[model samples]
Each structure stands twice: as C-alpha cells, then as structure tokens.
Target: MNRTDDISNLFSRFGASADSYLEFGSQFDYKEKPLALVPATPAPEPVVDIAKPVIKHCDTPLAEAATDRVPASSPVHASQSTAPLRHLLAEVARARQAEAQARNEEALRQALPHGRPAKTRAHVIALISAKGGVGKSTLASALATALRLEGGQTLAIDLDPQNALQHHLGAEPDVAGMGNASLNGENWKPLLLAGSAGSLLLPYGAMSEDERRTLERYLDNDRYWLAGQLANMGLGENDVVILDTPPGRTAYLDQALMVADQVLVVATADAACFVTLDQTERLLSERVAMGQAPLCSYVINQFDSARQFCRDMHEVFKRRLGSSLIGVVALDHAIGEALAYGQNPLLEAMSSPACQDMLLLSDTLKTQLKSMDVAESYAS
Candidate 1:
C-alpha cells in the first residue's frame, strides 16, 4: 500500500475516526485550505496571579511552571532606579558646600574692609570696673547709642551674668542673650537685639548654675575662645564693639582685655569707688608693662559738682589720668529717669548734661581711632 494510505489505515486502527481522516484528506486537495494542527480537546492552562511572588500548587514541575508563567510587563533595572537618588544626593552635598563657602567669604569680607589685611582687627572698646553699682552699664549703653547716632556701627555686649545691660538698652527684661547661645553652641547672629539709633545689643541670657559653670570652664580653658567668637562677627573698620563686663576680676574681664583695643575704666566719685582704683590700676599695670594691654582710659560717672569730695576726686582723676581722663559724666536725675522709663538717655535726653557728656566721650573715642588709623597708615 501507498505511505499516505498506510498512515490513514494506522490512524483508523489507533481509534482515529473515519470523518477525521476524510477532513484531513480534504485539506490536501489543491483548492482547499490547510487544517489547523491543534487538538480538539486540550487541557486548560494553570492560571497565575502575577501580583504575588510565589506560584500556586499545580501538577507541573516547578521549573516547567516557572517557564510557563508570564513575566512583568516592564522589568526594573537596578541602575536606572538608583541613578536619580545618587544624583539628588550629589546635588545636596554641592549645595551645602556652596553655602559654607559663601559664609566664609562673607565673614572674611566683613573682617577686612577697604581691602585691608586681616592683621588690622576691629577696634574693641571695653568698659570695666572693680565694683558694681557705679552706673557702668548705663554709661556703656549710652556711649554705644551715641556712637551709633554718629553713624558708627556699634555692638553692645553685656558680659555680666546679672543680665542687667538689656534694661538700659531698652530691651525686654526677659530677653535671651549671649550666655544661652554659648551654652547651646549656637551662632550669635540670631540673638542680637535692636537698640536705640541702629545699635545692636547682646544680653547675658539667664542660665542655670550648671550651664554657667560649663561656660566658665569653656572660657577658662581657652583664653582666645571669646576673642575667636567675636572675630567671626564680621565687624568692619568703623564698627565699634562695647563690652560691659561684670565688676571685679572675672573671667569675662580677662577675655575682654585679651581683645580690647581700648579699655575704659568706669569709676564714680564715691569713696568706695576711689579706693578700688588703686587695685584696678595695679591689675592693669602688669598688662601695660607686658605691652599686651590696650590703651587705657578712665571715665568718672555720677559726679556731683556740688559735693566737695566729688570735686576733689574729679580734680585728682584729671591730674592722675591727664589726657586719659576722657570725660566726667555729671550725675543727673534725668539719666536714672530715662533708664527707669525704658528709654535711651542719648535719644530721650540729648540735651541733658549726662547725654552731652556721653556724646563728647563718643567724639573722643572717634578721634582716638582716627589718630590710630593715621598712625597705622604711616607705619605701613
């Protein structure tokens, strides 16, 4: 028999229907279309849930089932997903570096004005006393205000832990000051408060004993710690920094001396105040001999000309200090009234003798600075 007839006979013997053979033979005819080679009754495929990671139980082997499963429509590439995150991180790092660089540049610019070298530091004026209750804080506030009124950028720093300087500067009694900032390792820029006629004030904020001890230790350990912080404030050539230190030989006073360009020893005509001058002078003489101290000056505050003792002390100060006696601030009730009313004497009572004396003191300081500048120029 022919191969085709033999294949047909074999299929019929193997349970293939005659009608199926006839249909297949019709497909081989020249004018007929080919029949599909699919089984009439095929088993249904196992359904897979693509959302889940694991495959359900089935009769098929694990490898064969995995091959049959449909993959995700869009596969994730490891590098593609992480590329944006890496780029974002790099951008943030660059931004932070840029900000730091900007701050450093600004600080340098402020420290060295008119293209002057960094060796020319800002002129620092510190008002110190051996005893308290001599109106040192009051005179400090008024002097700073007067300087500011004369178009000088003035910064008043109250180094007394009592935090009383803010009161004289018209600041709130409870305002946080430099002590809190130093303890928290925060920048001093945000703590600066506005004062009369564009002056800046930094109060000695309230602190616990622990905090106070910590700050004291910090200052004691490093002599230049306070100086370094003040240097970073970006003061210009015309800027004036007035430090009002707590009475007596304290750590704050030492720090002030370390950076002071001029020291104004505030004293009163009272006998107690006069007795303390010898001790204060002895303390300053050592620094003077070492050539480490700034130019020292004296100011007699609360002088009453009507009192004979006051007049005698004033004359003695003039004789002792000569040119160093900057001025005598007459004791005026208006000065105390201004402070009690939360007003700056320089602005509230400009016509008062006390205010006029502060103005004259401001002018004296300006003249001293100008002369120093001229001397430096000549030296250079």
Candidate 2:
C-alpha cells in the first residue's frame, strides 16, 4: 500500500534479497511466499500450451498485482513475461556489489598509515592570484623557504605550466619533473629535487604542446587529481605542501583548492588588485561552502611606505581585509636581486624590510597552523 509494501512486492516477485532491499532504507521485514498454484483440470473446446507457465493478471497496477491473491474464478493465462524482470534484478545486484567494493577500498585507504603519528596530516597551502606578474611564484618560493627555515619539513609544488618555480628553488631548467613523470605514467616521488632552501621541489617540467594539453585535460576531468598525487608521495603529518598555482582562474586552481588546507590570495597595492578583491572572495567562498579551506587570507605584497599612494592602499587593505590581512611585505630591491642569484631573499638579506616582514608572516602562519585542529581537517 506504501513504498515499503511496493519494495516488498517487487522483491518477493523477483526473489530478490530482502537484506539488499533493506539497505535502501526500508524498515519493514519481508519474506517471500511461493505463488499459489492452480489445480489441474480439463479444458475443452480450445487447445492450450501446457508447457508455458501460468500468469495471473489483474487491472491493478503491475507493482500491486503481485501483492494480491488471485481469485479461483479468474482465468489463468500462459505467458513468458518475467525474463526482463530477472535481468533487471541481476543488474541491481551487480550495482550493489560494485558499491560495496568501492566502500571497502575507501576504508582501506583511510586505515593505511601516512608515515605520521595519529591525528596528523600534511598541511597544504595554495598560493593564487587574480592576474599575473604580481610575484605569486616568488612569494611561494620564499614562503616555502621560510617554513623550512623554521625547522619544518616542506614540499613546494609548481602547478603553473610556465615552470618558473624551479628556477627560484635553484633547480636547473632542463631537469625532468612532475610533468615528465606524469606523461610517462611513472612515479613523481622520485622526481623531487632537493631545493636549495632545505625543502623539496616538484616542478611542472618541460613538455610539448600536446603533452600540456593532455595534462590539462586530465586536471579538468578529475577535480581531486592533485590530492591523489600528493597522497602517493608518503608525506608525514609534519610536512607542509605549498602549491604555486598559475595566475587567474584555471583547471589547476580548481584542483589546488580541492585539497588545500589554507588559501593565500596574493595581491599588490594598486587599483587593479583592489577591483579583483570581491571576485577573489567569491571564488574562495565557493570552496569554503563545499567544506574546503577554513582559512582564506590575503597578503599585500610589494608594499612601499615611501609612496603616499602605496601607504594609502595598504591602509585601505588593512581596513577592508581586517584580520584576514595576514602580512604586508615591504617593497625591496633585494627580492629581485636574490631571485637573480637563485637564492631566497629571507636567507640572502635577513635585515631587509621584506625579509623581516616575511619572517613575521611565517611566524604568524606557524602559530595559526598549530592552533588549528589537525584532526578535524584530515579525519576519516
């Protein structure tokens, strides 16, 4: 008479597993009963196909027909109509089996140790910007260096196709890296280069147009490809991963946001960067709504106190972003100089304003990461 009754009738009619039907959220218990057979009798004036099974028919709906007992006076017709129902039941069983296997695989993955103590997992930080030339890659490299300087294990990954991050990390331009490994269907763990700043680097590497397109297509198709790739690297809980994403919105940004524990939006002191703030907030909000990064903060890079307009823009950002403004890095020529020499500015010029600001920012980030409940972020 109701949904449970409908399921019961269907299961009984097809001899399906009542336990499997219960898994569909049905609360009622069901037992299959054999259909009542008609007594053998003589039929005159018409030839009958006795080899065919008798089928009971009624004006009631097909789902309801099997639930009601047929009257003795009702004529029994010979028909072969149940083969399709049997096929449908077989398909349902196969689907259920596949679902069960997938759940088991997921449980096993969660159970396996990740080379870290219990209640810990790597903290993934993604650096993104609305436009290019805002020094996102340089900041990513410096931040990775700063974290490592603080005596933490770190891995910096270059998600941009330009592959410029390896240069800042002191890796040769011609070295094979993540892109090459992926193209060859090989492990990316062995491709990690020892960064000059005491951290590890995963460069995007050199690839042809076809290879780039193929990798981008893969990233577009799988939203969690980056997360899966990181998982295979055997990272410990104390390890921190920094993702240097390309400027503007792309498939790479989407994949990075899917796994990032923190999202750092890089901007400069300018009218153009100001206009993009609202859109950037919306982009991060979408991911937050889907249960991603709980911390999405802003960093004002290249701040110049000497220029009144630069100072005004910094004040405006401070007022607008409030506590979300994590740090204001003073503009310094040493950043470029250090990059030219393939070294981290924080290490090259520790007394410079840019280096001091970066150290303060790194300390703030470390404090925030420690206060966060790591268990909640990586819980099964």
Per-residue lDDT of candidate 2, residues 1-94 (tens digit): 8878888888889988555754437789899988869866867776568997665555788666765666657755546534577898999999
- Per-residue CA lDDT of model 1 for 1-380, tens digit only, reads 88778877888898885456543335463667779798588889977788976634679987977877757666778877666877899999999999997885676445332421232256788999999888899888987787642444788998899888888888766777788887666677677899766678999988889888868866766666567667667667877888999999999998888788889999998778778878988988878886776888898998899999889988877777788888888889998888778877787555798788888888898788788779879999
Clashing pairs in 2: none
Q: Candidate 1: worst 10 consecutive residues by lDDT?
A: 111-120
Q: How close is every model to the real structure, measured as TM-score?
A: 0.66, 0.66
Worst 10 residues of 2 by lDDT: 111-120
Badly placed stretches (over 4 Å) of model 2 are: 1-120, 149-152, 374-380
- The CA root-mean-square deviation of candidate 2, after full C-alpha superposition on the true structure, stands at 28.3
